[model samples]
Target chain A: MTTAAITVEGLRKRYGDVQAVDGVSLTVERGEFYGILGPNGAGKTTTLEITEGLRRPDEGTVRLLGESPFPRNPELLRRMGVQLQASAFFERLTAREQIRTFASLYGVPAERADAMLETVGLTEKAGTRENKLSGGQAQRLSIACALVHDPELVFLDEPTTGLDPQARRNLWDLLRAINDEGRTVVLTTHYMDEAETLCDRVAVMDHGRVLRVGAPSELVGELGAASLEDVFLQLTGREYRQ
Target chain B: MSAEAFTSLSKAMALGLLRDRTAAFFMLVFPLMFLVLFGALFKNDATARAEIVQVGRVEVFDSLPRDAREGLEEVLEIRRSDDRDEALEEVRAGDVDAVVWQEGDEVRLRYSAADRVRAGNARALVDSVVQQANIAATGQPPAYGLTTRQVEDESLKAIQFLTPGLLGWAVAMGAVFGSAFTLVNWRKKRILRRLWLAPVSAGTVIAARVGVSVALALVQTAVFLGVASVPYYGLELSGDWWLAVPLVVCGTLAFMSIGLVVGAWAKTEEAANGAAQVVILPMAFLSGAFFPLDMAPAWIQTVSGVFPLTYLNEAMQDVLSRGQSWGAALPVMGGLLLFAAVLTAVAARLFRWDDA
Candidate 1:
């Protein structure tokens, strides 16, 4: 099969005199863990939103499995899962009940919800209200809801922002497993260590434009740098904290 | 996909409603609030006695040889006063409900005619006593006849005149305030954004909200209507349960449109609550919530007429209390349609899918 799962050509976006995505273009190989690294407000979320069909670009063409990503085709939405940053649920609903509700939204079978709860390691705490869960548990529940339909492509925006080290490591393992299952995972994160470890390919973005793109080793080696953080700092004209 | 999809939407909305405890409380309170309110209206304050005063010596004053003094004392304290002006001033000041004055052959009753009914009752009691004493002593009927009258030109109460307004007030609140804040809460919680990303349409969202609100408004109407029909309010419900349908629908559309406008406009729960109340209280009070608008200022009436609740009250009164048919509420129907249309447009224009 042809390798690329998503193809973007000459993507551009502007917000009231500020260009958020400037002639950005890229391609993601099928079953690859594609990580986009950027600073805060570097238009990472904007680009992801456009790709997810939440926003339309001023100019460009996007092909997701060879179809437009939006008027938000139902067939396509069913195949792609999204995890928005700082997302939440009603406090009164249990984790199991919420997952079931989201499953219903996709017209999926009830057993799928149970399987997702099991997959996310929340089967024991499934009966607990989402608000009562620890941060890690809630994040796991969010992931469960997003993946209940077994989507092939996942968009995770800062999947580990509020996560502790243990939770983040748990999530990284989950992502690795998902990638191993021949799924395409597109994610954005500011954590350099996360980018170096989890990503199969990296796109270093600054000021809403990708300044560089390569394998982790290629990006690091091009700068004659010891770490991905130095390569990011050298290329983006900014420093990475820690 | 359509049938199964509809069921999924229905289930989601039901779950959403159940998830919000405050929404549940407001939903329940809409009906019960008016129940107690209308119950209090029909409650009898008549058990309390009214105060009045009797005065003057009558035409039979001379004939009551033995018992006239006692007869006068029994009707009132019978304070002896020479000044008619002073006694009339006290009556006008509302020191007592009414007063009486006696001339040589005719007895004159003096009190503010606005409260002339109390004056008439006091006059009757005094006349009967004086006439009994006359028959006992002179064995003759008094020459001047007794008459009864009232002090105030108007008599209004909470039940009959106000229940109609209360019914409208409750329905209006259910529609506008309920609708707006529900949307605001959904948006605030990012539920709308989540919903937008789903397969649901904007039209479906609006329709679902309408369905939920109409169901809520129905419960409120039933409770309020049942309480209002109790004998205390003198609600004379007739043979036409079918007649209320149009009013309920109109009220649902009118208020919910106001709500949609509010929900579309407000960014936060607090802003929505405040905006809804600002519209609600004036519509409740100024649109004859507690009393009739007939005696209120002409300008006030004219201004109140511009509110949808005013038309709602008039329509419901025509149907539930007065037993008029749906055809009779054409004025309300026309006004509500206009109000609903404009408010809906404004709200739709202002509706923001994002937090910004």
Candidate 2:
């Protein structure tokens, strides 16, 4: 079997006057926890969406699990999972109903949906409507839904952007455990500590282009910085939150 | 996979609509309220009585035979007046429908032509009364007396026409408002965006929504027909009542396609609401739902002919009031089907999952 989870070459996208994803290229290996770190408007989410087959690239090639992501190939989409930024669910549906509905869409057994909710620590609140879920709980529901079908590759875009510290840490642990089970995980965020603590490899991006890519410790060591935050600032010459 | 997706989505949408209080009211309660309110407001006006002033020769008016006076009384309410000019003033001021006077051997009528429909009814009644008197004067068997009877299957009341028109209005409202608002709200909430990421195709999503819309349309039709046919309204229906099933389906589908077009064009729920009003308001007025087409101007009737609701109302009236067969309503049904197909194609062309 092929070991690479995703591959991209010269991927490009434009929105009128703005070149949102300009010639972006990267590769993610199977079982690798990859993080794309960037500031706001760095096109991190755009790049991830294109690679996940949620969007079409204006130019260049993207392959997910050795198959092209263009033209919305159903076989490719069926084997991949995506968690979007600020994901929403049906307002009046209970969490279990929402999850089971999506599971059936993927032809997964109903029992799998319950197990997935348990894995996401939402078993106790399975009957809560989506509109009633707290911000953190909603994010966890999104994670549970993404992992319900147990695909080979997963993409999460800014999964912890609005989460509290404890909730963020809990999610980091869940993602780490999933990665240890040998499924490829790719996520995008702006948090330096998140990338350092959870990612096996990191790519620092700005202005629609990737500036650097390596193991977090190795990048810090090469730059002679005290931490990945210092290394990121040194490389981009801007604060991590900018 | 498409079938499963379609079924799941349809179930979810129907459940969601039921849970939504605002949507439930708009879909279920509002249409019936309109039916009862408007039906009650205009029910008695169908056979409007004409008011007449007998200005001169009260003895001449009183001299008419009792049967002739009774026949004219059905159409006219006569008020006596000794002064001729005062009765004419009443007619001019629109206080009375018309004024009648007897001068020697001839009787004359002075009426305000502005109220032409009522004035015409008064004139016909007065003419009949004169003919009756002439027949009595001859004192022989009449040569040409007309005979009339009610057709068992046909309904001639204005409410008969209004019921079908109201039912058409309800179906149109359900289809257009339901589809437009739901699509825009879901798109704004990123539901469509999320669904696009799933293995389900766009065509499945659309099919699911259209299916839900059609279901809602049918339910609205059934509820309205059932309520209107009760003892209160006594909807005069005949022929194959089942023909209403296909009529509602086609008519509601066409309006739903219009809603889809609005959904594709509107970027926000508020915009969708505005667009729906713009489309539905004119259609409701022009479809002859509020009044008969014969009562409206020629240009308005011609313009209303282009609206699908017009055909729907026509088909409904044909099936319910005229007791016509399904084959008789083919032209209107064809128009609805063609409208639905064409608009659905346009909506598909215009539809987008994301802002980009």
Candidate 3:
């Protein structure tokens, strides 16, 4: 049997006549760290959102671990974790309490909150309100909250977008450990370095379609480029800020 | 904690709100300031007869009908045969501050340059006396008819009338502020995204917020009403709060749901706050939180009924002042429920988790 964690075939969506996801298809193998790389408005988020069951695509089909991925089925939601591109929190709540509250939503024990806090190295700061946290600390707390239930699959969207270099490194390490534990992770990122280093396979998207999908080395090898950046530039043809 | 409890996400939300100090301060402390201020402002504890001259009482200056003015106890007016000469004599005698008489529709009034207070008092006294005369001539009281009699209900005190109003104000304020600020902040920070992606449903979030806001609002209502009605501190009840508290909670949910709608639809917390204030200010002012609704214009009464606050204010007045039951407040309470329903529907439809 095929062990693909996610399967998307011709997944499509439109927002007021803008074809946000145009005939895009890809497969993510189980236990693999997959990446979707694109710039703003490139449809990376829209594509990933459909896969996470947050949005219903106008056309196409999506299967997450052999189940249809829409309506956010409770069974699917229970086993999946997601860190949104912009993960807002209740500023008044202490980090630990916030995690505990979310855990209670899934009927997970409150003590699981403590374990996740420690994993994110925030046990010392667990009692602090989110508003009082330093930028890096707050982001880490958000990640801990998403991982509180220890789900089998996780989605990290622009996970390192606004983090400082040091915090970004800390996150990279944490992600590596999570992947090492054999959980499937699908992420979208603006940074090519982030994709190459953390991802096992990468899908570079442009204009609502996946232009290339392959192991990082194989994509570079095919382009005869020194790195993924060169391959990305060669494929997209516009080598500017985006 | 038991499965037998009705505790839902709403219970959790309420608990979370109670844990917040800022929410507590806005919900409880801010309104208490108004309570003390209005209480002191409205204090005629000394039987002081104070009157201010408002507009529209000037139409009766020249012609004084004998009957309406005949029964009145206090009428301060200036009688003069000459203009400048009469004005000079009045200024020296200090009997009345101003002289107002009409030559047709062009009513002329002159004031003493000496004392500002005396001038205003003199103006008000003239206005009232002339109004009384005008009414007497017509042989009618007012357009809608005026019925004036002493309320021998020795229990009707200023504080008694205000306590329930304060209770309603407190509950409504707390619920509205808490729900609005919390939802807006969550959207701004993207924390709502986590809930949208989690095993929890959006309904759970809405339920929790409503629960928390309603509970806190009810508590605030109880605290104020209890303090007022206690025998030692002046038992402010028409009866006990059994009927009042629940209706107040319903009103709280209604207002809180409106706040949530503002928060959910706004692009940011600041916008939500701004929108909430637009609604809250009118409710606070026009709903008779600071003064009696009877003091407002008739048109204001018409406008106020369109808001849940108008109903809540009316309900509080009935329960605490008139010692009425919840049945007396069904219309107003029903208005709040209607507002809550409409706001809930709109909020759910417009709520967005991501920046999109």
Candidate 4:
């Protein structure tokens, strides 16, 4: 039976003069792959972070797996995985050691680290330190770390933003495989194609509000636009972001 | 706190320290360099010597027994002064180590209390010479003899004082500045943020860092004391030197808590390093790390009383040189623990997983 993985209502956050996330509301069902798409300063990461429990909403209500997450509920954290845009690990620890360290935090054993490394195709680079990894390898290692505990829900903020096309495609397959295992995945990205390709449902956001939320084709077809990009441009205007 | 959390975190940090060349240099090499430099400078002072000026019929030098004269002249550099008052003025001003003049049949050694070690040695040498000469001339001990007294024991030289001071300074720098820089770097690199996202609590993460810091402090203390106590440095460890271990551990807790405060307050690595230096450098200088605060101005000494390093230095001196028991070192240890409790509270209040 499907249940709500996340539910938010009237979520708002203000950073001094800027309204980073304003009265945003959304819901993602369990086992669904959801995406929040927005341009720069559209509050994509801020809203995702709020939902992931890394941030506090100035005014609103949020529930992850039907429990409050604001005060850092360890039970919720144990069941969830997060890959921050700038996630980092100890530089001296090898890739395998890095996974082992985090796995140990969750009371998982060393063998799980090897399994996660193999799953991410990083088994060959397991002995390499963080500084020795390429950008793509490092990103893959981050994903492996996030999923090491076999969490029920995962949050990936711009997981493929800085990758080459090939690496991005490889990551898309990885995300699909994780979603195929019935683990709910929510990601934030400005790349329309990534949203169109990977997400079962996409929410178009601009100026701290959700302009639209539906399947990628539905979002694209509703505006009578050619593609998701055209729909985004039509909704957010043609002006370039600062 | 989970034992695995503490052990894994400390292992990672220790590995980082080993890989970081700059940290290794400061933690292991810098203190040794200071020890070698200071040791070489005072190497000759181990064998006591003196400088003396002679006045008024200094030919008494010619009449003294050859053995007594040569023995006295070996340790003392004696020079004839034509103006006795000027030579006496030199003695008063500590220009020479000592002065000797003969009155009737009595040979007098006039020495200033300043440079007490040199002055005391000079007085004893001259008294020995005069007594030997009197015995040689009359086959009897002298009726009136040269006498001099000094307030300090001859053993506590500048080197002895500096050994404890430098040891204390090394621990302070290693525990406080090292941890501050590491915490700031971890925060900047999002390592701390990653740990925060895990099941471990913030307090567990902080305790992990503290555990590593205390271990590092103990290792540094062991290395420093081992090197300093060698015959080349001639640093004597007091009979109850085991008390130094608790003193070092308490000081580590106190200073590492301050490091936590700096890490919690600083938003960047540059700011953390700067703030650490601001706290460490002034405390190092005022805490008698380089020299005793007794020679400093009264206000500076009063100011030195406020820093934990000062208490650590005094505690180190108390146990390392004076053979004081753990009971006697209570006040200094208590001061450090109080500092630890207060600063840890402050750090707990201010700590953030993200940048400030």
Give the alpha-carbon lDDT of every model.
Answer: 0.74, 0.84, 0.74, 0.84
Per-residue CA lDDT of model 3 for B255-279, tens digit only, reads: 8788778877777767877888888
lDDT of candidate 1 at residue A197, scale 0 to 100: 92
Q: Tens digits of per-residue lDDT for model 1 on A1-242?
A: 66477888888999998898998788998888999987776778888878888888999988887789767787787788877776656446788877877777678777889999999899999889867899888878887777887888888888888889999999999888888998899989989899899999989887878889998889888889999988877877665532
A179, model 2: CA deviation in Å? 2.1
Query: Measured against the native two-chain assembly using Cα atoms, what DockQ does each of the candidate structures obtain, in the order listed?
Result: 0.40, 0.61, 0.30, 0.63
Question: lDDT by residue for model 1 over B14-113, one digit each (tens)?
Answer: 6666667777666566546765765585566432222443355554543455665564555444454666777778888977655556666566666566
Q: Which candidate tops DockQ?
A: 4
Which pairs of residues collide in model 2? none
Q: Give the range where candidate 1 chain B is weakest over 10 consecutive residues by summed lDDT.
A: B150-159
For A9-117, candidate 3 gives per-residue lDDT tens digits of 9999999978999999999988899999876777999999899888899999999888986766877888888887665565567788777777777777777878888
Candidate 2: residue A33 Cα off by (Å):
1.2
Q: What's the TM for model 1?
A: 0.81
Give the higher-TM-score candidate: 1 or 2.
2
TM-scores for all candidates: the values are 0.81, 0.87, 0.79, 0.87
Model 4, docking class: medium
- Number of clashing pairs, model 2? 0
Model 2 residue runs over 4 Å out of place are: A239-242, B47-134, B148-154
